[model samples]
Target: MADSSSNSLFIKPIYIAFVIAFAFLISSPIGSYAFTAQNVIDSPLLTKKIGTNRTIKVDINGNGEFKSIQAAVDSVPEGNSQWMIIHVRKGIYREKVHIPSSKPYIFLRGNGKGRTSIVWSQSSSDNVESATFKVEAQHFIAFGISFKNEAPTGVAYTSQNQSVAAFVAADKAAFYHCGFYSTHNTLFDYKGRHYYDSCYIQGSIDFIFGRGKSVFHNCEMFVIDDKRLTIRGSITAQNRKSANENSGFVFIKGKVYGVGSTYLGRAKGAHSRVVFAKTYLSITVVPAGWTNWSYVGSTENLYHAEYDCRGPGSESKSRAPWAKQLTKEEVAPLMDVSFIDGTDWLPAWL
Candidate 1:
């Protein structure tokens, strides 16, 4: 009995120390750059390779090739095939920037998300027209920049009052270490095969919407309640009309939290697909997990689901009946970069 008591005393301190360390880890909030060096995907800042040496500078102080971001993009030829770097200097550019479909392979680089920002204020019935920064070109890449639409909080659930921070409507587009800020419909990921790495997206309702087949890796989603609407808001409203369309939003290893309760996603189509895998959900996420509120279509076709998610809001006992509990084999493809065919064209990925 004396020997057993001595062994217990020796192990107690070690167990207590491990518990304290684990508590610290769970309490720590994700920083501006969520992932460590190993987890980052194709980070240009770390890779130091922008595909080509053809560099253009955009400085607001009239010191570079152009004063506006649009001007620098305009300088690129319509049939641009090779990678060209447009280094935007540290400043808040207050204008609407567009990358037309004709101009491709343009890499928009910034000092950092905190230092470089593109801001505009416009609310319209059209989501694309109200965007502060719109990208319509394929093979586009942006890093360390902030895109924002400063339109005041509009009445929720209204199309005419939609404010979009960024509109991505082209294929093979990627953003890294960037920030998107708006009140409603923040990121219109309309149609594309896109990748977002370590980005911060903030909005209230239907913030990340559209039919884009995209992968969000280590991205942080901050939700703000729309006081105008009595009903709870949703983080995503994916519009995958059919399973054959190959359109969905897959979020991996990110954190979603903020003020007011909201669903992980709401059904926007009969086959609307949205998956959250290995993500952290705070109390901000409602117990229902997903909703089909305005969508009167059959919930049987909806693919709203969660896999390996944690936190207070991830409890599945009260999850919606339609919400799927996927097995490892079922979720393997969605959790991989191959889901978007990133290994073929992307410079690097996990």
Candidate 2:
């Protein structure tokens, strides 16, 4: 009896070991939480490749690197960067900054978008480039930060040029819970594929402009006007010049509110394409949903359309003759996951 008991004890341990191994193998692929925990345990010493030790803490009162945003960006190493984190404290940074192409993997985290603002005032016709904050870095992410261009109200009327607050010209970039504030051309997607989720974008004319493939999901778009002018004066000016270019703009589950006029949109590019799926529009949107850039030509080749939009402004009967209301069957192909999906190139915080 003693020999049998000892044998049972040995077999029990083996069985337990087998069970543990099986659990790990099965959970690793199916459970994200378990997989992440295992990865951290297995590679505790691993670190980010770029900006591994580069951390810039910017507080209005705290003693750290330069106080201005431009100064801090200039201080980071020039080329071949892995990752860098810039922690901005609660303050309004009034400066125009640029993230050059040389530096990649820049993660800017602010205290909060409501508290931390990077603001500048530059009209597109003021000899300043249309884009206030131009980012040329790949895999760039901005969280809890606000980009604002405080151009004068009448400045846009005098100058028909588009003024962009934040212009993104990078690939695999993402903006989470950020605020883009401007009178016109708030956010410009100049190039590459990008994503903006849970963000607040405000503007008057073509607030969200650009020629890139992007996805804006669960975002709030506010058209602030003292008097009703137009809803979406200019939404997209996609520049899909090359046949190989796969570029378009997607707005999913977004809310549009008008502060004044009721004109919804205008297309600026020859082959510009924009989609509004599962969106809510306010009464400020005109009955004719879309307008042509000059009202003399058809935007048929531009691929402008809407699907499953709700609210008072979503009526299809009064929509522009040139505007194509897409059916679920016609729009299903454009809803592919890979349309806006790229390499997991976004930062961890985003």
Candidate 3:
């Protein structure tokens, strides 16, 4: 009705602006991040039918009490001792979560492992900060969750000191039916009395390391292969300071398999001790198991042992001289849950 040429110019500019905006929406990093953090389909593990009654909810999609996990954690009162149950909804939460040492008795329950995933791109060079989920508090329990580190597990991975999926530096912490995914230093058990049950841990080099006194039961310690790795990968790098340190790592009734020719462990600390008792090892394990970090003949101080383990890798005749094949009597002390003194705080264990 107005001048036809004027109307054509107005419509043309508006159409062009809309097209440019749509293209930018698809190409921007914020768009990608939002897509990655979007809510997931309800996982079977996250069903409300499950017995998760006494807990607060964290839904990243704004349908729950909190949108972020860190906010839910911060809501807890300081120095509170009662069990704080935090039920996380299903989503790919792109966050670096940290449970500080001051907080304790925190129970983090995820809907399901395949549903709720916390992912971070931090490298091990960040040390404790490298963990996608850092648990510094004691008396903690996590069920049906996944912590993943998205990094290239190169054969020559010197770029980072040690990237960890979950860095746990607390006493009396327990993980059940959880999944840890990474390449190197996947589970940093940093000086704690902890228990892992029915968890899946995968890594390549020194995957499970630290100075913690932890026991792994019914767990899968998987060693993935790196084609670039000419030198074989190792599973553990325990750092127990001395015999009197009351620090050791024991894996009982567990599965050690995957794509690797790995040593059982390395002596990172002077009196590092590890025991694989009544477990299954695949042929991927090296025969001369257990190596030293630096000093030769350091196996004297290293207490690496295996007892009645099955599979092709468990045959111990060719094992390292420093690593012993323990008898039942010797394995008795390490086999019990009391090895980590879990009776005090391990829920459903006592």
Who wins the lDDT comparison? 1
Could you give the candidate ranking by TM-score, starting with the highest? 1, 3, 2
Q: Relative to the unseen true structure, what is the C-alpha lDDT of residue 177 in candidate 1, on a scale of 0 to 100?
A: 89
Which regions of candidate 1 fall more than 4 Å away from where they truly are?
Answer: 1-50, 157-160
List clashing residue pairs in candidate 3. 45-111, 46-111, 124-162, 124-163
TM-scores for all candidates? 0.88, 0.78, 0.82
lDDT of 2 by residue, 1-350 (tens): 36998899999999999999878876775455455534311111212423366679877665667688777788778884667877788898878889888888777777668988898877765323855677888878777889888766533345635567898988878777789987767788778988887789987776776678888877888877732243346444555544467888888876888666545566666666788888898886778877775544546666678999999888889887777788999888666335666435533321
The superposed Cα distance between candidate 1 and the true structure at residue 295, in angstroms, equals 0.7
Question: Which pairs clash inside model 1?
Answer: none
Q: lDDT winner between 1 and 3, please give it.
A: 1
- Per-residue lDDT, model 3, residue 331, is 95
Most accurate candidate by TM-score:
1
lDDT of 2 at 190: 79
